[model samples]
Target: MTQLADQRPIAAAQEAAVDPAVNSSSTTTSAAELEQLRRARPRGPHRRSPLAQVGVRLALALVAVVALAPVAFLVSLSVRSTDDVLTGSWLPGGFGELAWGNWSAAFRTIPLAHMLANSWLVALGSALVTAVVAVPGAYVTARAGKRGARLSAALLAGYCAPPVVAVLPLFFLLKEVGLTNSVVGLALVNGLANAPVAVWLLDSFVRRVPVELEEAAWLDGLSVAGGLRRIVLPLIAPGLVAALLVCTFLAYGEFLFAVSFAQTTASQPLTVGLSLFQGDRTVQFGQQAAAALVGVVPVYVLAVVAQRWLVGGLSQGALK
Candidate 1:
């Protein structure tokens, strides 16, 4: 045993002679080398130089300012007096002295509250209709492979065509059904018009869903519809919300169809009702701007509220 112990020291010495790093402790030496390697590694692409980062930030700030300039101008117009509007000054006067009566004047000129309600109804209806048509269609197309691609292309091609071409046909169709000059009628038209867009938006989202999930669902005794409802719908909810919001915005801003279908104050949405601000003799510029600003509020609020889902839906298929 004594000789064996003496030989252990000899073995240790030989090992230390061969590898000095292992003489102290292998773990400690390996950790040190790892740290050194980490320090020597190159920075990632996102780690920009200070000057380059500053320039990029400045450029982004400039773009944001340019994009928001029109909205700021619209706000300025909304607060202007009739005389200031006629003068065409960017700002009516000192900010504190600017007229605040335009908002009230807009409400007075037309049933602004009622028009806003009509617009909301149409927008909500259009979104609902779009979701109903788009979700099933998108899912089917996404799973259909090349045939689905052709169908999606065809739908988008129809969307690319001018809405004007179908205006007369749509008008006659609605009239035949006794739906002309009604908000419901207008909502139906807008919903069908925007369905193609919604389907296109949702196709990628549906495709991102793994076939394995549906296969598992089937193993669990779920039918195709059950799998869609139980698994796919929940997974693609963000995309659905995004598509609905887009359809709502499209319906809200729709003009040609709104003008043709909804003629009365009860049925007319904000887009068509805004025309009342224009007279044969002159335009009620301040009132128009005020109403326009009011009309814009819902859009902004929706964007802010749904910001997360919107971004998520858009980027759903980007990474995974």
Candidate 2:
């Protein structure tokens, strides 16, 4: 009896030692499995690297720096004195040395008021004239293709024509007609030069207008011209504004032939007035930059105003 009881206790102990859970706790995995588990365990959070992220951010910073450089230089030059501008580098170590006399004398050297009026007259006049001529031409061309479209395209070509090509002939023609160098003469020239583009713009726009509106108007005994003036013109006023803005900007910045056509400050535009600052020896970069910035204001204003029309006009043509 004593021997049997001791044997039973030993057998129970051996069975507990051979259990799967006890074996797994100490060393379940084989040598190869243990090696793989040790290798697979992550050493750190940076499994790869953030180099690509750093590179993208760096590239964006470079672009921003490049873009801001010119604008910053321009502003800096504008505020600095002429001596600082001429003697000092493009960058000034100090801000106090800037010469502000150019801005102060800008009005005196030229009849700035008169020049502004001339610029407005040329730009606004050309834009208005272009809208008038182009709108009808574009409408007809877009509504009636092939023949009318060709005619419209031919006119658009004139806008693309070199100013030099037109300048001599236009001058001679105007002189022969006794209209040379006059405000009226310049206005007419600007108007004629910009009209073709207007026609082309209006042509495509008119096609987007629903035919039902025109048919109803025609049934009411309104002639095509009358309908265009009343219904079509009103509907496309946004596009007209956009066209006016584009032509005005072109006319305002025009250089090549405007200089040739204009003679004195009495009739000369701002563009010409600004050019007088570039002396034979010293170019007043500060004053030039300031003046250029001043000119840019009107363009910015016109662009903002015109953009309001663009969205609605585009939506009407596209979404509808």
Candidate 3:
């Protein structure tokens, strides 16, 4: 009887080893392990309900429409007759009645092609100047620690001051240098004025470049300048391009200095040339709109071409 009792206990032990149900501890351990694995698994973005998705899409569409309303109006105005434009019609009268001659008239009234060339020259020069000044400034500032902060503050302080404050001084300076009433003069002024903004933008990008790369270059026998040229500059090209585009846009739309500096048609940009559409007694609204549309084309094309780089450059360091 004692031997039978001992055999019964041995059989129970064997059953517990073979069957998980017979061993609660083993079952509990497996469940705990599974729970831990479930906790460790990364979660995906929360799935929105169909209704929520529709609402979000609709909101985006609405914002797009609102933002594009002015552009749509401009397009309509470009095709409208002088009378229709004067009447302030929201839409053009009819497709058949669209004044296609306004485009030709605009080209004839102003030296549109020449003004466009001048604008391009000024804008490009301004961008070049901004890059030349800002790139180095940004680099120096990025690595300068507290001194950089002070320098950046001073630069931005200059930026914060109204453009009007410097207009007289700049004009006189340009006049003394014989740059007044010239595209080159205008470009130089715009470029200098935009340098602060470029510096601010480019500093972020320069900071994004890893210091280890520069150290590696140094170990490879490259100087600071050489490393900047071959290593840092290439990595920050997108930011440089973005800064150039921003400066170009700013210079292109600058009217106060363009009007103040460029007195003759030879030196005037598209911004100044647009005034030619207005007369003492009459305004060529359709023609002006047509010319404005022409001016918008280059800017639009640039924005589209550089949109990706611009966004990336601007968005860097935002998260950190």
In order of listing, the candidates' clash counts read 0, 9, 0
Q: Could you give candidate 1's per-residue lDDT for residues 227-271 as a string of tens digits?
A: 888899998898898888878888999999998878788899999
Pairs of colliding residues, candidate 2: 80-98, 80-99, 81-98, 81-99, 134-198, 134-199, 138-202, 138-203, 139-203
Each prediction's TM-score versus the true structure: 0.86, 0.71, 0.84
Worst 10 residues of 1 by lDDT: 311-320
Candidate closer to the true structure by TM-score (higher is better), 2 or 3: 3
Superposed model 3: Cα runs more than 4 Å off: 1-17, 22-46, 215-221
Off by over 4 Å in 1: 1-13, 17-36, 40-48, 95-97, 219-221
Best candidate (score: TM-score): 1
* lDDT for each residue of candidate 2 in 185-280, tens digit (9 for 90 to 100): 676778778777667666666776777898899999999998888989887776676666667877888766567777766767778877977899
lDDT of each: 0.88, 0.73, 0.87
Clashing pairs in 1: none
**What clash pairs does model 3 have?**
none
Clashes of 2: 9
- Model 1 score (lDDT): 0.88
**Tens digit of per-residue lDDT, candidate 3, span 126-150:** 9888888898899998889779968
